[model samples]
Target: MPELENNFYNKNLKPLARNMRNDSTKAEIRLWCEILSGKRMLGYGFRRQRPVGNYIADFLCKELMLIVEVDGYSHNFKMEEDVKRDAQLQALGFTTLRFSDREVMQDIENVWRTLEFWIFEGENSLS
Candidate 1:
């Protein structure tokens, strides 16, 4: 039996998510190839470009109820949208973590540590 269920997602969005996965950004590719793929996040499974609710998450670990988003320069102008997206995800019982593209490219170790803390230690710390 699966340990977690993805009841918050929209089935219709799967096609869009698949398309996004096919044309991933540089940051998304780097993160997936170097860290999040191959069940590498402490043996957790992560799916790239998954839709939850009305939005497509950058990356999702259903078991952890965690969404990891890699933000590029465009995100600077999309703060409002990002905030709204985060709130919607939060409403559906998921946590969203955002990291800058520079951070993922230049300081992946720190990103890994942050993810580790969130997955293993920070769940109880959420308000």
Candidate 2:
């Protein structure tokens, strides 16, 4: 079982992180991490540079099955790709959220507030 899980991680996650290593969103990613470090909004423990099937997310909360992506202006051109990816993730029962780099970098407190609201709102709604 351990070997199987190890193989799965290598096949699915490691490659994706490799591709995102020099990604353009690093600064925004760091800012998000900083905000997440002390926040209770993650709903569970937050993992940085987490690997899921064939992908690497900027932030992941396994218990919440949540993936947060911070997009730069360039993401406007990749709506189709994002849609496709989100669909697959949703099909797997993950809730995905996206915030623009500008939002996180310029006014990060707002980002934390929004995330906190979403986390508690979702929990209350589900209950």
Candidate 3:
């Protein structure tokens, strides 16, 4: 993973990211508490509401150069923005995986399985 530099850090966005962390959405809270927090996922670490470049990633794993986005209803109208955000993250050497609120809220186990496969296996194959 590329080291984060001053150019990538936007001071203004930190506060927003911190605020989002404190007042997390239901799906974000659930995903964090249940699956991603506490150095989980084969010892990989994840940060919630992490500021990456100009956008804040829902969940970021620096070691794996991965960003997991948990999309809610608002995302329905933001396909173009999401595509741009993914491209920006990809330019910074991160691959993003997006999941829906219903998927996370209803079948988190399958989400976990997909994440596990992506992180530990699929990413390697892609490389």
Candidate 4:
């Protein structure tokens, strides 16, 4: 595994990230436990509340440079900010996948399929 640059992992965010993990939203918990944890997503590892640049991603797959975000109710009003944040992450070579709280809560199977499709497409592009 290639070492991630120091800038991508902000030490100052460690405490905040930990707190977020401890108090995860329902959607976050479901996604992590069911799909992301223990390399369950096609054997790809994921870290929850991982700090990247100045932002904390809900779930990060370092090997794939993928960041999965579970947005809750407040996200509806922060769409612009989210877009900009995603752009910044993209500049850092991370693909951001955003899902609403309702989507993850009510239709997780679809979410899994979406993630699987993205991973397969990404792998194919690499090959």
Instruction: Please tell me which predicted candidate would have the highest TM-score against the true structure.
Output: 4
Question: lDDT by residue for model 1 over 61-119, one digit each (tens)?
Answer: 88888999999999999999999999989988899999999999899999999999887
Lowest summed-lDDT stretch of 10 residues in model 2? Answer: 1-10
lDDT of 4 at 52: 94
Clash counts per candidate, in order, are 0, 0, 0, 0
What TM-score would candidate 2 get against the native? Answer: 0.76
Candidate 2 residues lying further than 4 Å off, grouped into runs, are 1-10, 15-26, 38-43
- Candidate 4 per-residue lDDT, tens place, 30-104, comes to 999999999999999999999899999999998999999999999999999999999999999999999999999
Candidate 2 local lDDT, 1-127, one digit each (tens): 3553343243556656766654637555565557654454553667666676566677767667778888888889999988988887676667888888888878788877877887888789999
lDDT of 4 at 59: 95
Off by over 4 Å in 1: 1-6, 122-127
Q: TM-score, each model?
A: 0.90, 0.76, 0.90, 0.97
The best candidate by lDDT is: 4
For candidate 3, which ten residues in a row score worst on lDDT?
1-10
- Report lDDT (Cα) of residue 52, candidate 3: 84
lDDT of 1 at 53: 89
Predictions in order: lDDT: 0.90, 0.70, 0.87, 0.95
